[model samples]
Target: MAAKLVTRCSLLMQVLVFFLAVVPDAFALPLNRLKSLTVIEEVNRRGPYLGLITVIESEENAFFATGAFKPHKTHPFVDLSGRRFRVGKIHGEKVIYVRCGVGMVNAAAATQQILDLFDIKGIIHFGIAGNANDSLSIGDVIIPKQFAHTGIWDWVNLYSTTNLSDVVHLDIASYNVPKGEGTNLLGHIGHRNEEFYSELGKPNTAQPLFWAETSKHWLHLAANLENLNSTMNLSDVVHLDIASYNVPKGEGTNLLGHIGHRNAEFYSELGKPNTAQPLFWAETSKHWLHLAANLETSLSNGFPVIVFRGLSDLAGGQSGENAISKFGPLAALNTAKAVVQFIKTLQ
Candidate 1:
């Protein structure tokens, strides 16, 4: 009986030893007494490092896709319209590319989503805008020196009535769709008529009569720019002259009649012509205004954002049939290229 009891005790000791041997080191060892604790702590306390730059496009195909970055994930694309998100690499630089869709609301939403989901250092909005100013041609690129939310007060009450006393000096000018006028061309000036006419090979006649009228239109545009500068506190508003009003050659007379006489003064006097309404359709600026507002908010939050637009149509009702068909897409491509170039500069 004594020998059996001793054997049992020996087996019990062996079982305990086996169990301890098989246990994980983490559980067996006291975590508080680990020698590598300091190393792990150091790794955990690392500071903010440079992250990948993100480029977002309103259209998927609008993206140039030549950069050094590759799409980080493929499982679920980031999109509002189920449009697949694509990522590519350019020179070891990471670019997360996604189509945010068209218009201001989509652009703003996309910007927010990208900011929330990724570590984006800067944002570049690359798209096409109808050139409200006539001097702009089909493929000219415009880097907004300043953004104006035109006619802000006309529709919404952004600033409170109580704070009306605290006038936030707006640097940009606003346009009010003049009252009772369906398409009164008042308040509107043809700043780029001479440039447009010049491009059309119909430079204003050198005759004194033409020069005086042309001079008036030039002064009018100059005055408008000056007023804009004063209000926006910007020294210079940079605009590119692309996109023209090209009526079919045979149909020129009819279109010209609709646009009124060829004189620059006549065009300038016809403020906000219904014909030009499509290009300046308050909807366009509304789209841009949302973007500008979001950008302003982001900037306030200490993020850097820039907007780049290519002029695709003359804001005035001056687009020729061919201009509508060809220049629009071409202008968009040029804008995309410019965006690509601009991104490279950021790196």
Candidate 2:
């Protein structure tokens, strides 16, 4: 009887082993089939926002933007991943307003977090920035159609030559850097394209990207907001024609050829249109604004992005002392108004 029992136990053990190997799902826990939950999901009362309003910091520009934001009745603020996102409405459109700290990394991280944790249909990043376009003035706002990352550059050795197309080699002699052995420490600053790598079969291959364009559909919507400019209290010098100030040489042109084309070769090489001519201000691009806009467009996959920048300072190009302090609030307010107006136009 003992021998018979031992044989029966061995046979049962073999059957169990075969069943476990062949049909593993039969004994699997239900937990394995559960969907992964995001932090916003765990909170139980968060997003599904219509848009996200991102700014660099909360001191000046952000202050104005938040003031315009009307919070939701139930659960107005949601704190997650070290960010205090204001769940609110801008111009009746549901939005998540957050200050994205500062710099590229901060902006990128905050943008990604909001996207991952919420259902955002679009983004509107607005703030005051230094003005590179002379045609625009402090307190004036601009909405660019596209953006580029111009900060990433190659500092070539002094006197070194580059023959690459679309590369800008700007000599830095006027800045007055240290002179080492009768030569500046670094040569010209080479403006190169933003480097990108493919995630597919050619991960090692580098691709050059110049501009990140904003959504044309969003841009078309923004066009309706142009009438808002008529109501803004802008500077008298706003969109002032620099050519008018130039002394004409009597050949139906100014003495300096075109005041805006002082660096015509530079603009030509970069493929930027000259803004010296009348009504050519539309082609001008703001620097810091471009960076923020490009960042938003690059990180977003499902949502459209629009950027608004109010010219606060001349980016060190002003004739007198920097006017950022005096004009920052006005610039910030102007952008806030534009953002609100833009939001109303969106569906």
Candidate 3:
């Protein structure tokens, strides 16, 4: 009996040592421990943030809040899981800022992380976005009232026997399938899961909600900013049109001086007197762009979210390469300015 007891005690001690070595600190901590072994502890130290600001790219952050508004000099960033959350004051409002990285997935993850870790009232996502609208200029700021996740979908398998007639489907096979020896997809099917909320009691099953609407109160506040004060002049607009149309170098003449003095020598060499003017550019109310990019990661987060996306590139809708490389910084800066002004309006 004494020998068996000693063996059991030795085994128990070894097991306890192994368990201690294997278990993480988070799980090993006592129930009474107040300090957390997670991002919550790291964030709570300098948090109770008024709002959370999210950006997409490094350049966007550089021009947006990093250069203009500026993060706090002392412990500016809270590095958590490879993401640097910039803790700062924008217009005297305590805010936590972070670059959401690029794409909808990155945006969703970062937004969720901020919401989970920090004590923020709302989310304000701003970044340079691809534009397809002709009326909106490169540096224009667009505060979309509604945002949608159009990228989420199911690529229907051609071989599958699933009948999806009731569902919204796009038949890609109808558009001539490539004759090459690769597998071809027949169509794309969309999903519309009911947004069930325990607090709301019943999910709104009226219609499939594709668009996630932004905060109306935030939109109302943003509308009061200065209007039609775009820094881009007629000259800049005209030059962009020239690039978009890809007019032959010698064929086009800047007769109206929209793009500096007309090349008199070139016109003389071509033996054509440039008399006619091209109406390539027009002005619209610069308060806000009517359209925005399709990225809506934060809009569906169930929190009060507002987005201010600066028109960066034309999304290859233009003739040549994308214009983001040339004007992205400017666009980001413009949107940042709008966001700063908007934050000032908040109480």
Number of backbone collisions per candidate: 34, 1, 0
| Residue 85, candidate 3: C-alpha displacement in angstroms | 1.2
Per-model root-mean-square deviation over C-alphas = 19.0, 12.1, 10.8
Q: Give the lDDT ranking, best first.
A: 2, 3, 1
- What are the models' TM-scores? 0.45, 0.64, 0.63
Task: Score candidate 1 by lDDT.
Answer: 0.40
Q: Write the per-residue lDDT of candidate 1 for residues 1-347, one digit (tens) a residue.
A: 99999999999999989888876664644443242343323322331111221223432344453332344343222332343434444444555555555555665566665555455555555555555554434455554433433323322233322223221233121343554444332222111111112222335632111111112232233233322222221111123222223433234343221221211110112232233321323345343444454454344334555554555555435544424344455555555555554444445
TM for candidate 2 is: 0.64
How many steric clashes does model 3 contain? 0
Ranking by TM-score: 2, 3, 1
Most accurate candidate by lDDT: 2
Worst 10 residues of 2 by lDDT: 261-270
Index of the highest-TM-score prediction? 2
Q: Global lDDT for candidate 3?
A: 0.53
Give the CA lDDT, 0 to 100, for residue 286 in model 3. Answer: 13
